[model samples]
Structures are given as C-alpha cells and as structure tokens.
Target: MSLQDLHGLLSNLQRNPGIPLDLDWVDSIRVNRSAAERRAATLPARRTVKKKYQAAWLLRAIACMDLTTLGGDDTPGTVRRLCAKARRPVRQEVLAALGAEQLGVRVGAVCVYHQMVPTAVEALQGSGIPVAAVAAGFPHGLSPFAQRLDEIRSSVAAGATEIDIVITRAHVLTGDWRALYDEIAAFREACGEAHLKTILATGELGTLTNVGKASAVAMMAGADFIKTSTGKETENATLPVGLVMARQIREYLDRTGYKVGYKPAGGIRTAKQSLDWLILMKEELGNEWLLPDLFRLGASSLLTDIERQLEHHATGRYAATHHQPMP
Candidate 1:
C-alpha cells in the first residue's frame, strides 16, 4: 500500500473549493537509483536533431507573453502592466516576420501575471496561438481562495484558454501539503475546460527532494501541468530542478498509468535552452511527451533569437532583431 490513505489525505489536502486533486504519498514511495541513472544517461542523445539547423517550426510552438495586466492598460508606462507590448507588441510581429519560414520544433508556452491576461489575449488574437495567464495569486499565492478563484475566472473571461497559477509556498514549506494540494485542485475546478499549469516555484522550495515532492503533489492535486517557477522567484527553472520534476513525473506515470504534463518555465530565453529542456522531457517521458499537451516552455524573449539563428542558416546572413522580437 504505497500511500492509499485517499480519504484521509484528501481531507487534509482541501475540501470543495470545487477542485480535483490526488492523494500524493510520493515521499514514502521509494526511488530506484538504477532507473534514475538509466534515464539520465539516455536523455542527451534524444536532444540531437536529425535534420540540419533549420528554423521553421519554432514560431507556432511559442506561447509568448509577460502577464502585464489581465484587464489593465494596453498603454505604455505601465511597466508591470505593459508586458513589453505597449513597447514591443511582437507576439504577432514575430509570427509575420517568420512569414513562411517554419520555426524550429522547440517553442512551447508563454506566461503572464494575472493582470496582463487580456492584453496578451487581445494581442495574440488571430495568431492561432494559445494565450496563458498567471491566474490566482501568481507571484504570491496570498489571496483568499475566493479571490484566487475569481482571478482565474477573470483570466478565462479575458480570453485565456490556458491558466498558470502558483502553489502557496508558505503552506507547502510548513508541511501543509494538504492545503497546497486543495488550493491547486480547486483552481483546476475553477478552470472549467481551460488548461491549468501550476507553478511549484522550486527555487523557494530549497531542495531537489522538496521539488520532487511538490511536483508529485501538484500532479495528484489535479494540475494539468506542473511548472518550475514564476520567473520572479529567486531561482527560476534550472537543469537540476527540471531533472527532479521530470523524474517525479516519470515515476508517477509509471505507478498510476496516467501521464501528467511538465513545464520548464523562466530563464528559458534561448533556443538551445528550450531545446535542452525539451530533450529532458522527451528522454524521460518518450516521444508522446513532446507535444504541447504534455510539455511547454514559458519564455519571453526567445522566439526571435531562434528565428535569427534559423534565418542565418536559411539566408546565409545574420537576421535583424527588428524582424520580430517575439513569437
């Protein structure tokens, strides 16, 4: 019985915040050191591309946004609320700039704070891209449950099909796993048909073990995807953190036959970085995990750089940054 205290654990995790979560007893579950090493060894090879350096599939893969304001000013000077849009507005610019050139097979998802959802939503209209918003108390999950639920509602209302939220660090650190779990589960319920990406804010967790624990807890807590950080956190997504999360996701799926999603957000601002993380997921979870439903990369300034690299390869000359700075 590896953590079969469903009734008891569920009681501790949360109530009818109208969310769905899982009873996670992963810590009590053992780790297979041999299996871990085996996975690590095989991951690097999958990262290598079969084709030459091309830049055609990256654009459609990127969900680019900064979360300026869910329903705030689409105007400049509102730095936190502007999302480089009032300044850059390159979400579509990059798409058009890429023109017919296919972006590499990397880019994933874009993220923004709760307040910025609508702006990102509006900017990305007709671009055939999914809009993600940092709903609930994102940078900090201090707001009340109702408030957080409303925040999710607002983002969805603003046209966000994907909702990214944060687990309250205070609760998780205090051994209050149940509270964090319940909160995440409830958020999922509030999300309705929308996709939910929950941020563990790993830098704040302070250990790979804690990161592993949080990742498992979030998946069980009904998170459609478990993410690394908010980008505002002290430690954003790193290789080791990604490794730990991937390992947990692998183990969970191995046990339950249900494959959850993993997202490596923050500090992913380049093509190589994005590709490396994708390698981590693919190697750990297999080719089926390569799609957007299972994995995503949340970056702000990466799409165009990949484009420049691709264009240089395509045209035999360096591409200008002005071509399109975002995807």
Candidate 2:
C-alpha cells in the first residue's frame, strides 16, 4: 500500500493497551547470542530490493523516520528548521518525478529535547506530525525517580504528544527486574494519553539476554514502543541487537496479543542500513510492522542519505552530500 493508505490504516489501528505484568514470562526470557549474531550477519547478503522497488522501500523508510535534533546547543531556530524539514522531507522535484507528491509523504515525527517541544509543536502545527520529546533524564537516565516522572508530565504539558523516556540501566544491570518494571510503569502512568517509548539503552545492558528481558519488561509495564538506545551509548542499534528486540516483540505478540513498536536509534546513517532494518522487520514481523506507528528510525543524517539516494534514482546521477543538507 501507499504511504497515504498506510496512514489511514494507522489512524484506525488500536494502540497496545498493556496488560498486567507477568513475572513468570519475564523471568523465562533467554537469548542465544551466537545464533542471533549469525542470523543478523546473513541479513545484508540475503535481502536486496533494487531499482523502483528500492525507491519504494526508501519512501517507506522516510515515513518511518523520527526526524531528530537532540543536542545540548539546540535552539528554537534549529528546532523550527528541523520541523520544517519534517513537514517536507523530500525535495519537491524528486517527489514529483516519483509521482509521490499527492501521497502526503513526511517523516514519522519530529524528536527534540523537552525544552524544545513547544518550538517543534508550533513549527509543525496542523501538519499532523506529532512532536516527540526525550524526557525522564534522557541518555543516562540517572536522575532521581520522582524527578524523572515530573519531567515526563512537564513535557506532555508542553505539547509533546509522545514521550521517549529512558530506563535506568542499573536496574537491568543489577538484575532488579521489579525495580525496572515499577519505574517504567510509573513513566507510562505519567504519559497518560500520550504514547510512551521506553528506551532500553541496549548498549549499556551488557548482553543480548539482558536486551531481550528488558524488552519484555518494558512491554509488560505498558510501553507503547521499546527503543534500542539513546544515541549516546558507546554502541547503538546493531542488527544483532535489533534481531533480539524484534524477536521479543514477536514473542510478546504471541503471548499477550499486544504488539509493541520497535525503534533502533543511533548510528543508522545510510540508506542501506535503513533497508536492512526494514527487511528485518518484514522478515521477523510481517509488513504490518512497517508502518510509522509500529516502527520508527531515530536518526537525522539518515534522511539526508535517503534523499540523496532517491535523487540519484530519479536523475541517474549522484549528488554531493552538501547539495542535500539537513535543517
């Protein structure tokens, strides 16, 4: 289906209303690192959609991107510029050449720090692009528990419809599953009506087994989505890590009948990497997971590369990176 059709379907689809936590299920989780790594290594060699089909997949990637700007120096001007790009991600000429102008194509959402939420909201006003804020002591997530909850509430009050809260890595590292569950559950309650994305910061979690268990815990505590990293980790969003988390999502669906979204942020900067993740989603969890609601790519430069590739596909010539700068 086209992006527009997918948007319509997403609007009517039911969000994952989380169920009560099942300790038995969370404790039973285990991951095979060597097997997962071997499987992930074979993905790039196995899947290759090219030409027009590749272009179509690129468009799908665009629709699933969380056009992001998360830096300490970010200002109102920068946030506004990012929101404008989120509104019209692809160049008009390129979109027209592909006959996708009427499809209303845009990125999944515009992500920013909590302080910049209002600026992004105003810039994307009436564009149907939700503003997402990284709250709950983002990146490290070391703040006091009460303060973290307060931050989520404050961001929602500031017009952020989606909250990306980070989990306390110590809870996962120390094997404090109950503490992890309680913390995420509190963040979910703080989110209220807004969708909550629990960032696992998988790079800091130590093992693939930990990543799988954290994924299960987050989903159990009512996370609308379970994200891979905060982009501040030493390593973020590897395919093996993604495969483990995606399998957890599939397992969650089978057991609880609730489908939680998956996002692999940080270090995803190329068009081919985006395609790899899409293929991972398609192969692991059907085409239904391809929609923006169920999947999101959290990156900024990734979009510029996708635009460049689409332009090359349209004009039969590759353009310099400087020609397609991001806002």
Candidate 3:
C-alpha cells in the first residue's frame, strides 16, 4: 500500500494494553542463532528496490525515523535545530522533483534528552510530531527504581508523548523474567497516555535467546513498542537481534491480538540499511508493520544519508554532504 493510505490507519491503531504475565509463554521462547544469522545475512543480497521505487521507500524511511540527538554536549540550540530538521527533513526541491510534496514527508518523532523535551515540544508545535524522551536512567537503567519512575514522569510532564525507556539488563541476565515484567509494567502505568517503548538494550543481553525472552516480557507487560537498543551499546541493532524480536512481536500478536511496534536503533546509518530494515518488517510482519506507528528507525545520521539518496534520485549526481546537513 502507498504511504498516503497509511496515515488514517495509523490514527486508528489500537494501543497494546498488555496482559497478565505469562511465565509459561516467556519460558517457552527460544531462538536458533545460526539460522537467524544465516537468514539475516541473506536479506540484503536477496531483495533490491531501485530508481523511483527506491526513492519512495526512502521517503517511507524518513517518515518512520525517530530523528534523534542524544549527546552529552547537547544544548537547547542543538535540540531546536534537530526539531527543525525533523519538521522539514527532506529538502523541498528534492521532494518536488519526486512529485511527493503532498506526501507530507516528515520524520516520525524528534528524540532528545529529557531536559530538551519542552524545547522539542515547543519547536515542533502543531507539526503533529511527538517528542520522544529517553528515560528510566537511560543507557544503563541503573538508577534507583523510584528515581527512574520520577524521570519518566518528569519527561511526560515536559510534553514528551513517547517515553523510550531502558530495561534493567540485570533482570534479563539473571533470567528474572518476573522482575523484568513488573518493572516494565510499572513504567507503563507511569507512562499513562504517553506511549511506552521498552528498549531491550539487546546488545548487553548476552544471547539471542535472552533477546527473544526480554522482548516477550516487555510486550506482555504492556510496552506499546519494543526497541532493539539504547544506541549506547558497543553492539546495537544487529539484523539477527532484530529478527528475534520481530518473531516475538509476531508471536505476541498471534496469541494476544495486540500489535506492538519495533524499532532498531544505533549502527543504522545508510539509506540502504534503512531499506534493509523496511524489507525485514514487510517480509516478517507484513504491510501493517511498515507504517510509522508499528515501525521506527531510530537514527540521527540515517536521515542525512537518506536525504542525500533522495537528492541523488532528484538530480542525477550526488550533492555535497553539506547540502543535506542534519543539525
């Protein structure tokens, strides 16, 4: 289906309300790492979208991206610039050439430090783009439990409609599924109306089996979305890890009839990689998962590359990287 057709469906999507923790289901989860790796290895070579179709797919990627800025040196000015870019991502000239000006092309959200949520919210006002905040101690998830919940509340109070929270890796490491589930459930309650995106931080979770199990517990505890990483890990958002999580999402849907979104953050920096992820979602979860509501690409540099690709499509030659700056 066309991207335009998805706008309405996104508004109508039912939020994942969560269910009682089912240890039996969580314990039953498993993964074949070699098979997952073999399948992931074959994705890029197996499918390709070129020319005009490639441009369209890239545009969809832009719409599904969480245009992010999570640096230690981030300032109010930095966040404002990021919000401006998120609002107008692709240049108008490039969009006009592709006859997609009316596609209303824009990134899915502007992700920033909690301190900058109000700045992003103010900058993106009336743009219909939500502000996403990384909370619950973020990256490490080691803050005292009460403090983590307070951080979530503070961000939500700051007008962040989406909270991207980090899960305690220790819980998963020790196979403490119950602890993991309760923690996520409490975070979901604190989130209230704001969507809760549970970052699995899969990179530090030990194995693919742990990745699958953590994904199941997070979804079972009511995460509106399951994210692959905090973008801080040494290894983040690998295709094999993404595949395991996608399979878990599919299983959750089949059993509970609730759809949870998937996001692969960090290490995804090229336009081709964006298409690879889009293909993964489409092939694994079908067309519905391709929409921004159910899928998001959490990257800051990915947009610059995508804009460059779109510009290349609009004009036969590649433009200088300066022409497509992202904050």
How many collisions per candidate? 20, 0, 0
Q: Which residue segments of model 1 deviate by more than 4 Å?
A: 1-24, 29-47, 50-110
Worst 10 residues of 1 by lDDT: 1-10
Question: Candidate 3 — what's its lDDT?
Answer: 0.92
TM-score of each: 0.74, 0.97, 0.97
Ranking by lDDT: 3, 2, 1
- Go through the candidates in order and give the C-alpha RMSD of each one to the true structure: 8.8, 1.2, 1.4
> The CA-based lDDT of model 2 is what?
0.91
- Candidate 3 lDDT, 59-138, residue by residue in tens: 99988999999999999999999999987898888989999988888888889989999999999998888889999999
Residues 217-264, candidate 1: write the lDDT tens digits. 788777777889877876798877777788777877776666677777
TM-score of 3: 0.97
Q: How much RMSD separates candidate 3 from the native structure? A: 1.4
